[model samples]
Target: MHSFTVQQINEVLQGELVGNTTHSITGVEEIRNAKKTDLTFIGNRKYAKFWADSNASVAIINDTIDLEPGENRAFVKVKNADLAMAKLLEAFQPETPVFETEIHPTAVIHETATIGKGVQIGAHCYVGKNVTLGDGVILYHNVSVFDDSTIGPQTVAWSGTVIRERSQIGAQCIFHNNVSIGADGFGYRPADDGRGLVKIPHIGNVVIGNGVEIGANSCVDRAKFNSTIIGDGCKIDNLVQIAHNCIMGRSCIMAGHSGLAGSVTLGDGVVIGGSASIKDHTTIESGATVGAGSGVMNNVKAGQTVLGYPAADSRDMLKQWVALRRLVK
Candidate 1:
């Protein structure tokens, strides 16, 4: 186990030290699960009571709060204990697996494709005509980059991921396993002859900004005319679906199983919880938060917290629920 002295941790956190700096902390854990060699943190006031009884040898605490006077545990008090804990966790994180520069023998690269410096193309991967893979990009096993696609420097596409035609992926972006970027939009028109629906040609592509991380099995559909845009620092959880022409602003977060229908627009810092669904053409303003299992049928104003099916303001939804319960009585 990797260990660091309390003083060393204090230096990195820039926190006020209140106890034994010489003590060694080997790992980090929650207050309820900490061991004597573990470091824990109290970021919220509710967790303060656990400080006195926690088994951790070191605790990172918020500067605004105070622990009990007689507690034996050591402490590092910082402006934001949660942020400090994240830094400490990152410091202790293991490095990612490295690959050799040699391209795998089974990989197929079209002669027209542009391969950049230090790129690693794994077994069974295919780089199609005019595909441009920037320097230091890694395409793991079974990945595919279709014709005219451009993946920026240091981007990574895990196994079974596909970057379809004309997709533009930015630097340091991460496409998790089985992710499909630039897939055909689910748009269709009623056939004139009363036959099956005619598929609308998705001629446009997807433009993903830098630092975007799309989770496993997620799908971002290509646009009908223009691009489906995912802005910088957006984090999309597993199984999420972003339909064609959707434009998401920077730092937006969409949790697992959440979905946005066609032409949806999300302003910066909007958060969509698990299994939430936004109707087509809806606009979610900046900093709005849609709660889990919500069905957003209308535009949500900035800074609102919405919840429930055919979602309403969180506070209003609670009142409605209370009224329904009273009626059942």
Candidate 2:
């Protein structure tokens, strides 16, 4: 339990204090849950109702507000109280987590692998031959990087994440728990004489651009020849399936459970809603948005908003709904 006097907080935030400046704040809290020894901030004027006879020792407030400071609670005035609070919180917050710098006893790192500075290889991790890990990379428990894999600087792979051989992930990428990259792509043919199926080999790997964030339990499969590319600044949500050879452009956003089939191409600033499915080889242009539960089979023009199965135009979908409602009347 770290304690900071009101004077100490003002030094950190360079804010003005008034009304019983001698009071000290023990901890920070939300407006509704604040205790007598705590400091809570109020931003919106509508939330001022919660401040009546509040138990907090101090209120960090914006300078624009016209209010009187009471004896029970002092006021720390600032241009932006929220941003000021962030500074204080960061200063008082715990240090960046330490996974031991020394390789764990259970970790198996191939001798040929190249690991850069400040790397932490956690329990039971397996690094294959020729794998290259950049500076400040942290691989949590049971994560595996197969042969020839390369992870860029400042990346963190959470527990149970797996990168198949030859995969390449860019800088500052975060792979949440159980993410599987460069796993076998689905390419199969019916066996001879109507026998069991024969699965073709997935020969390619994945290339993730810088600043891309992939969520938990997502699977991005390997392509046949070329790399399956995730463009820079792409944000993907949980349980999404990115099939082989799909290329996402910069700043594309895909919501939870969305699936893109093989060879799909998405332009910059495209937004895909939750549970949407884009068909194979489809091309979606820049700044286009596909609504939730949409099934996109054809190309979506730039700056267009589409919705529904087979993805009709947004205006068309709305008109159809309106006509359906008029039928009942």
Clashing residue pairs, backbone N/CA/C < 3 A, model 2: none
lDDT of 2: 0.90
* lDDT digits (tens) for residues 159-277 of candidate 1: 99999999999999999999999999998899999899998899999999999999999999999988999999999999999999999999999999999999999999999999999
Error of 1 at 72 (Å): 6.4
- Give the per-residue lDDT of model 2 (tens digit) for 201-247: 88989999999999999999999888999999999999999999999
Considering summed lDDT, which 10 consecutive residues are worst modelled in model 1?
Answer: 66-75
Which candidate comes out best when scored by lDDT? 1
Task: Pick the TM-score winner.
Answer: 1
Report residue 277 deviation for candidate 2 (angstroms): 1.2
List runs of model 2 lying over 4 Å from the truth: 1-96
